[model samples]
Every structure is written in structure tokens, then in C-alpha cells.
Target: MDFGLTIDQKSFINEIAEFCSAHCKAIDINDLEKRGADPEAIEQKLAAKSWYGLPFPEEYGGSGRGYLSVGLLIERLAMGGYPYPGRLQITMLNGLNVLKNGSHAQKMDLLPKICRGERTMSISVTEPNAGSNIASLQTAATPKDDGWVINGQKLYSSGAVGERNIIMVAARTDFSVKAHKGLTLFLVPSTRPGLKFTRLEAMGRNIGGLYEVFFDDVWVPNENVLGEVNKGWSAMTKGFNVERAIVSAGYLGFSERIFNHTVTIANERYGRNGDSGKRGAVMSRLAEFATELQAAKLLTYQALRLADREKLSIEAVCQCKVYGSELAKRLGDFCAEVAGGIGYRMDSLAQWYYRETRIVTVGGGSSQIMRNVAAAQLGLK
Candidate 1:
């Protein structure tokens, strides 16, 4: 695969980097973790530049670039280790999925606002009962006169808080059908009655505001159904592929952050004993992390290219998520180890990195779930 960036892609990369360098200063992980804290100030700050919609269609107030450019933007944002840009990308991509499959009215109402960064969207898939087993999602959408009465609970949904609109969700639309069938995606306004959000406390990337959304007979219009009824299962899966690709890009950025911190600390920090000889062990670990980070980066880029081509099968995307997230965790651990006592201290960047890294293994989908996907794809069972 040709990894070389074209002139346009190169220019896009430069623009994103300049934005991050100029505006992303002084924002650290701790500042991002507070409940009900607003990332909107920084978000609006970036929206002024209009890079928020790089991957959506230009007709919908976007840049109209393809997935390759989108992936590049995500990668750069992740590498900055700042959260607002990543949140923007996640919201834009989720909104785009609705455009890809939702009714014309749905697209018209939502996509433009999302592209302009005036609104945000999120995917609500996980629940107390449904973590990796998406088929087991118990959120129910009962048929009603106007549209559907959605009543269920979702957990760990990122960007639910403070988003203008949300992708309200449900499952088992037809009880006769199997678990995976009849599940559907919906376009619900956060301001809608019966839809409530509770913020979830998490380790890293707190700016994303992971949430528990409850749809208590949340009334949605028939016009809001995304794609066909039973066919939502297929559409949601496709959206997940997109989500995983974006996540892999973020992991790549996070890996770079930890790896850089590890090296910087190793080179400059004295050993707890104040001996320069401690530098030798630190450098050795840094070299090892660098090597692993390179391996994970190459795999992630490969996945990005495949996703750009629309060739990312479930198995391939899962593989990318597994390696990239795990690599991030390993890098974080290495940073903490290299920093010794300082790394373990609260509010230190390395401690934050360590906390954030653990979540990567569990979020998106657990590493075990990815392996299960790969095995099923390979017919190993």
C-alpha cells in the first residue's frame, strides 16, 4: 500500500498539526476528567477553523474528503493527546453514518448541524447486560402510533452529555426474530422528553463524557428510524467498523504520547537513587517500547488503509483494535515504570497515562471480544 500522502493530504495534515500546536497547549488529562465539565469552549475554538467535518460530504457543510483524510485527522488529533478534537471526530463520524443510512429527512435535519459542529451525536450500544454481546442488548423499541416507544438503558456511551442530539437506541423490535435481528438505530434529540443522561466517571479521555442514557418510553418519530427496520443490525455493524477504525487511530495517537513521555523522562529524570546508571535500564525499556510502538503503528496504518478502501471486514478491524489498544496499554505501563515514584504519584501525567491505558483494553470492545471476532471469522470454532 502506498502510505505516501498526496499534496492535499499533506496539506490537511499540516493544517491539523498547526491547529493543535497553537491551541492545544496546557490542556492535560486531569483538566478533562471532571463531571459536567465543558469541552465546548475548545470545541468551538476548533470549529472556527472548520476542520471538524473533514470526512463528511461537502454538500452537508463538510470538507468532503474520503476516509484516508479522515483517518489522518483522527491520528493527528490523537497524537496531540488532547480530547476535544477527538470528540469532534467521533460526533461527525456518528452523524455521517446516519446520513449514509437514515431517511432524507433525517439526514437533512441532523447531518448539516453535525458537520458544522453545531451539534453532536453518539452511539448508544452497550448496556448493563450488553457489553460485548451486542446481540443481548435488551433496550426495547415498542411500536407506537406516531413512531416507536423506546424504553431501555445504555451504558458507557461516549459524548452523550452536552451533545445537542443523540442516536437513541433499542433492540428486539420483533421478538420472533433472533437476538441480532430487529435491532434499530434512532435519531433522538437530547432535549426530547423521556430521554435522560447520567454522566459516567472514567479514567482517561474524560472530555468524551461517557454516559448512561435512559430512554423511558422515549417517543421517536417514524421518520427518525435509521435505515430499514430489521436491517438496522447490518447498518449498526457497518457503523461499528467505522467506530473501530477511528478508535485505532486514537490509540495510535495515545501510544505516541506515552512513548514520548517515557523517553523524555528517561533522558532527563534521575534515578530514585540519583545515579545516572539508572538511565541505562530506562533507555533499554524505552527502546523496547519504541520498537513495539512502531509495530502497532504499522498495523494501525494498515487497518486505516483498508478502512479507507472500505475493505475493513469485522475480523480485520478487530485485529487492529486489539493490537493498537494493547500496545497503548503496554506503552503506558512502560512510562509509569520508567518514571518510578513520580509516575505513581497522583495528577502526574504518567499516572494519567497508566489509568487511560487500562481502559483501552476494555473499551470499544474488550481484547477478548476482538479475539473472539477473529476466531469466528477464521472459523476456528
Candidate 2:
């Protein structure tokens, strides 16, 4: 497959890089981990630039760019030390799901707010008992008069921190049915009563930290049902391919940055030390990482292209997510080794990456879960 970037794509990437350089300084992950940064200003800046709407259709006040364009923009932003902007772009995934399964009124009311960055969205799937095994989620939504009353807890919901966010929560709507069959999605506003958010302390990238959200008799209107009741499992899973592709792009971008930083550290340490053996070995390892990074990039781009064409295969997205996430972990470890004593410092990029790398493996889906998905796609029993 040709990996060439179109002229317009190239120009767009340059524009993103320039904007990131002007507005965002490289984040100090250590500081962020201690006390989360306020994302309000950054969110507003990205909104003003229309970066949040890159992947949505123009009718929703978006740029009408394809998923591939969104992935490329995410990569460029991350590489330029502007990872937070990409978080805002994640609303596009929610927007896509809403467009596919939401009522026309729901779409009209939500998509424009998402596109304009007037609000943020999060997918609340993981519960205490369900991380990769989405079918086992215990959140319940019982039908009430003209609405649903939801009661349950969600864990590690990333963007559900503040009042301006809306979470797409998965709950069991029919307990008599099988776990997967009973599941349904609801669009719950964070400002609604009976909703409580408790922030969780994390190792790195804590700009908007993970949260444990409890919905105690939280009421949602009938119109807020995200898709057909009792069919949300399919609606939610249908968007995983695109979400995984974009996540893979973010992992690839962050890994590329880590790899470059390691190279610079290696060169500075041994480039002129006359220690030929050590220098050569370090260079060789860097070369291996570079090769892996390139392979991950290709896989990510292929997945994005397929998603844009509405032909994304489950196995393809799984492969991209699995390989790209694992590569980032490995790159982080290699950076730590190359940075030696300095890497142990809290402020070191290597240390920050090492702490953050595990999130990728666990967040979108675990490595084991991705492998299971790939095996199932291959008709494995």
C-alpha cells in the first residue's frame, strides 16, 4: 500500500504542528500527575481552531474530514507535544456513534455542541467488574414513566470529570435476557442529579484524570436512549473499529516522540565517548525501535483508511491497537534503559512514558482482549 501523504494532507499536518508549537508547551507529566492541569483553556483554544470537529460532517458545523484525516491530525498534534488537543477530538467518536444510532433530534441537539466543543463526551463502559469484558457490566437502567432511572458505577471514565461533559453509559435494560442482549446505551448529562464523580489518582497524563462515576437513580428521558433499547451492545461495538484506529494513532505518535527523545539521549551520552561497542549497541537498539515504530504507523494508517471507507475489519483494528500499544510500552522501556540513571527521575520523559504506557494496553481494550477479537474474526472457537 502506498504510504504517501497527499499535498493537502501534508499542508494540514504542518498547520497543526505550527498551531501546537505556538499554543502548547511540552507537558511535564510529573507535575500533571501530582495535580491535574485545567483543560478549559486548552479546550477553548482547540475549539476556536475547529480541531474538535475535524472528523464530523459539515452539517454539524464540522470540517467534513474523513477518519484518516482525523488520525493524521491526532498524530501530528501528539508529536508536537500537544496531546491534550487530541483528547478533544475524541468527541468525534461519540459524535459518530450518535449519528449512527441516535434519534434525529438527539443528533441535532448533541452533534453541534460536540462539533463546536461546547461540551465534551465520554464512553462509560468499564465498571468495577467489567473492563475488557463489556458484556458483564452491572450498570442498570430501568424504565420509568417516560424515562429511565439508571443506577450503577463506572470506573476509569476519562473525560467525565466536569459538568460540561456528557457520558454515554451502558446499562443492563432487561435483566431477564442474556448479559450482552440486555445492554443499552444512554446519554446522561454530568450535571444531572444523583450523579457523583470521584477523581482517581493516576501515574501520568492526568490532565483530566480518570473518574469513578456513580449514578444513583439518575433519570434520563426516553429520547436520550442512545440506540434501540436492548440493542446497544451492537451499537457500541460498531464504533470500536474507528475508536481503536484513532487510539492506535495516538499511541504511534507518542511512541515516535519517545523514540526520538531516546535517540537524542543516546547520542548525547555516547556519540563522542570513543566507546564504540556501547554506542553501536545503542544505535542498533534504536534502529530496531525505529523499524517497529514505522510498522505501527503503517498498521494505524491502514486501519484509518479502512474506517474512512466504512470497510474497517475487526481483525485489522485489533491488530493495530494491539501492536501499536505494545510497541509504545516497549519503546518506553527502551527509553528508560537508554536514559539510565536520569530516566529514574520523575521529570524524565522516559519515566513519564513508562508510567503512561500501561494505560494504552488497558484503556481501549487489553492486549489479551484484542487478541481474542482477532482470533474470533479468524473464526477461532
Best by TM-score: 2
lDDT of 1: 0.76
lDDT (Cα, tens digit) per residue for candidate 2, span 185-213: 99998899999988888765566666789
RMSD of each: 2.5, 1.8
Q: For model 2, where is the 10-residue window of minimal lDDT? A: 82-91
Global fold similarity of model 2 (TM-score): 0.95
Clashes of 2: 0
lDDT of 2 at 344: 96
lDDT of 1 by residue, 58-170 (tens): 77788777766777777787677566325676676677677678777877777777767788777788889888788888888888997988888998877776636576465
lDDT values of the candidates? 0.76, 0.83
Q: In model 2, which residue pairs have backbone atoms overlapping below 3 Å?
A: none
Cα-based TM-score, every candidate: 0.92, 0.95
For model 1 the TM-score comes to 0.92
